[model samples]
Target: MKPWSFLHISDLQPGSPRSYRFNQAMGENADTAYKQLGEVEDVDLLLVGGDLTRDGAIHDFECEEARDRLGSLPYPFYAIPGNMDTCNKHTSVAGATGRDDPRLNVTAEQLDHFALFFGEFPWSFVHKEVRFSGFYGAVAGSGLPHEERMWRWLEDELPPAGETKHHVMVMHYSLFIDSVYEPTWGLQDKEEYGRWYFSIDQPHRSRMFDAFKRSGVDIVLSGHIHCRKPPETVDGVRFYRCAGIAMPQAANLWPDGDTRLGFYRFDVTEEGISETFIPLEKESTAEGKYGPGGHPHPEDRDYSLAWEEPPEEFRT
Candidate 1:
């Protein structure tokens, strides 16, 4: 009957100066987003789509700070771990990128460590006649014990849990890149590597879609790719590839892809849910950092280039 609003923000990896790499623009952009979030009114809750920190997988301080920073928001938030917070998706074969992909696969301990700060994920609850569900989709193909639990939860637990006026699913990675049924992208193919890195693979994507349908999910919000594309509806579900809070990536990769930096605001009412893009007041131009961009090998990291002293463990 009455209307309410909620927010979806992701990839605000406000990097720490204490790390080998520190991007000042990202930090400033994240700060701007935080201030803007504080000003928004009548929002029920925030669905943090993930990548809450720059290097949460390795640095406990970053995880702790991300928790505290988000906790300062005007309302409560339900969050899931992004790849940066844990580790990249599982891959036995290295990609076109020089990084050792398999060695960087998300570990069970990494997942648990993330939970230590953000709480257990694959979580669902009903708020204001709307069902909100969040999960780390990367775990689907991880082959870890958590993968079994994720499957069990998606297949068995959620379908019969209950019903609601609407269901919104929050995930870090987009379920698909271009189309829901697109062929799986390959890691070895340089042209297809970005798509492969950004989306869930074949059987898993279809399986998740089926589970979402069975569970009455009408809307799905995801971030990982950072470039927001026009919403794509497959079957009966509307999939929104949300904007990033940090910086834009792959903006020109898609014809309709929007390169703006910001987040999404959704209003729910008796009619249904309507969404809007809230672009950041200003994109950060501040720049300064150490180390390299993209995933860098640990051995290749150079703490000596850091402006501030890095943590003892990070310094070689």
Candidate 2:
């Protein structure tokens, strides 16, 4: 077969200035990546890792904007929902952030809202000889219907469609922080909050890994950390902790983490699939913003500060 290429990008949370708070840099970075991605001549469709919007959980228009922009690309693409698109990972108790973590838990409605635009996830299909699959594993313990459906798909459904020269899996959350067998991270612990926030919790974590191994998923592409790490190969599968398009993060979390902003270009041929990191052509230096960041409480949002008048619906 002739060699072909595809691109993988995630965490492009280009927020709307219409929203209460906007990170100018994040919005610009996402725009730069999107434009750059379009310029790349690809042989196959793009694989969108997730977090396509800043507040898609509450703003359907943002979801629509994302869908329209991505849809305009010359090639087709598949995507899963990020925590920002749906809601945070399921949390039983408030974390060290002092925000209402319990209230921020992912909901069925939010998941369905994302699917309404992006399509139902836990979806997999064969393209040429390779199999591309995407799932939101954060749903694993949410006790929502999506959680059960995702598990069912991962266990019974995924293994059956076994067309493989290579199986590339896209997941929104890292399966683990440091190692596949790492223990469950505690949300209540201040120092552990970052890990807890970025990773899929246990039993679910182990089960997901089991599914990965059982289905012969050799390359697992994960986002949500916003920082790329040196590829980790375990139990024969290689985990690519992809970089964030929205911003850099976790500068001190991992000694080897690469905090550059970029997307991955993968080349597939007889030798097998090879990955390359294509740094964004331009990193937006645009500045200025209104309102707070990081899951701010509703009362904290002052829509009047928006550069543009937000829609009446979002003004609540």
Candidate 3:
């Protein structure tokens, strides 16, 4: 076999100026990434790690637009849903953010909406002796039909996909914050919001880890944290906490966390997979009026502030 390359990027949630919420800088950053990604050559595939839109949960147009743009890539791209694209991870109790966490919980309809646009997820396929698999780990324990599918796929379907030279698993949320044994983050604790927001909770985390081991997964890629952390090799598997292309976050949370805005290029060959970080050619310095960040309530959204007229449907 010959060495092949692929690109992995995520969290390009650069919402449009036509929406009630728009950040010029974030949008430009994503544009930069989009342009830069197109310039790369000879890539076998593009693995989109999710959060492809800012408000895809509420707006179908965002998903359609994203599909068109991503479709323009030179190579085939595989995708999964991020919180912004579908909905935030399931939360039984309200979080410390004061936002209605339960209300923000992921819904079946939203997952259907995402699938309608981006195709069904919890998918697995083999290319060039490597197996690429993606799933929405956030759906675990949600009791939604998608959650059941996720478990069945991970447990039954993926593990038996036959042996491959390498198995690369893509997930939206980090399986754990620092260690696999780390306790589930508490949403009610103000200090744990970042941890809670970024990771999978409880027994689901352990189950997924076990399944990965059984499936002989060589590498795991995750986004949603925005910041990239140093890769951790547990047992024999290498887990990559990927960087976000749209913006950076959780800079101060982890001592080794890198808030650099970039994507990853992996070269797989007989020796091993070599990872390289490709920073955006230009970081957008553009700025504009923006509403309060961090999941504002619908009532608080002000469409009148948009630089462009908000679509009639989005207007409140």
Candidate 4:
């Protein structure tokens, strides 16, 4: 099959009016990055990982606005939900509701809103010789019925009982990496409202990874960690964790502190897949907006967020 190029972006996180300043900064950064991608000559598809909003409140229109902005891109775009995405309620379709009203907490309006904008959950499509399937918020132990359905779909699609060139999976949370530590970081934190967020417990993690292993998926793309690193292979599957578009987070995993805001480009072919990290030139340096005492409040002594060099493993 002919080789094709696609843009992968994640963690837009549009804050609400109460946090308009944050949203504005993030939106500006995202717009600039999207424009840069458009300038590239030969891109086919756009894949947005998740965290489209700061909070999933219907009042927080930033996520919808951001989606419209991204839809203006030259190529077709696909997306999935992150933990922050589920913050708002989703209304059920007349016949689409699950048993036990799995989406009982979701409002019909919210569900309709998401469906109208993003389409049904656990959506799938095929392009070229590749099969692209997405699992919205399929972290280990989300316990959400939709998440479980997505997992089942993944198991079914993995080893497509027929001939296919490649299988690619997209989701908001990283399945292989340890994004959630013992403490509340990443998306695993338990919110005060009794809502269990994105962390995947041991059994679920094992089952999910085992399914991936059994299915022989070629790659998994995720975006919750917000690190500026290239794809890494785990259990024979390549996992590409796209960087945040706005407000690069301090490297929680590494003490040396490697943090920068950027996205990735995947060049896929029958031969193999090549991925590159495209650092945002406007925000590349540690000066100005990202300088010390910037909005994200990087540790004063740690100039690492802007200057720290990436580890050898991140070099690709």
Task: Estimate the Cα RMSD of every predicted model relative to the unseen true structure.
Answer: 1.5, 1.3, 1.3, 11.9
The 0-to-1 C-alpha lDDT of every candidate, in the order given, reads 0.89, 0.89, 0.89, 0.58
Off by over 4 Å in 2: 160-162
**Residues 50-111, model 4: lDDT tens digits:** 77765443433555676677777788888877655653222222112112222333333443
Model 4, runs deviating above 4 Å: 16-24, 88-113, 138-143, 157-162, 178-199, 255-257, 284-316
lDDT of 2 by residue, 153-262 (tens): 99999864255868999999999989889998888999999999999988898998898888889899999999999888999899999999988999887999998999
TM-score of each: 0.96, 0.97, 0.97, 0.70
By summed lDDT, the worst window of 10 consecutive residues in model 3 runs over 157-166
Runs of candidate 3 exceeding 4 Å displacement: none
For candidate 4, the C-alpha RMSD (Å) to the true structure equals: 11.9
lDDT of 3 by residue, 19-48 (tens): 778888889999999899889888999999
RMSD from true fold, candidate 2? 1.3
User: Candidate 2 at residue 34, lDDT?
Assistant: 79
Model 1 TM-score on a 0 to 1 scale? 0.96
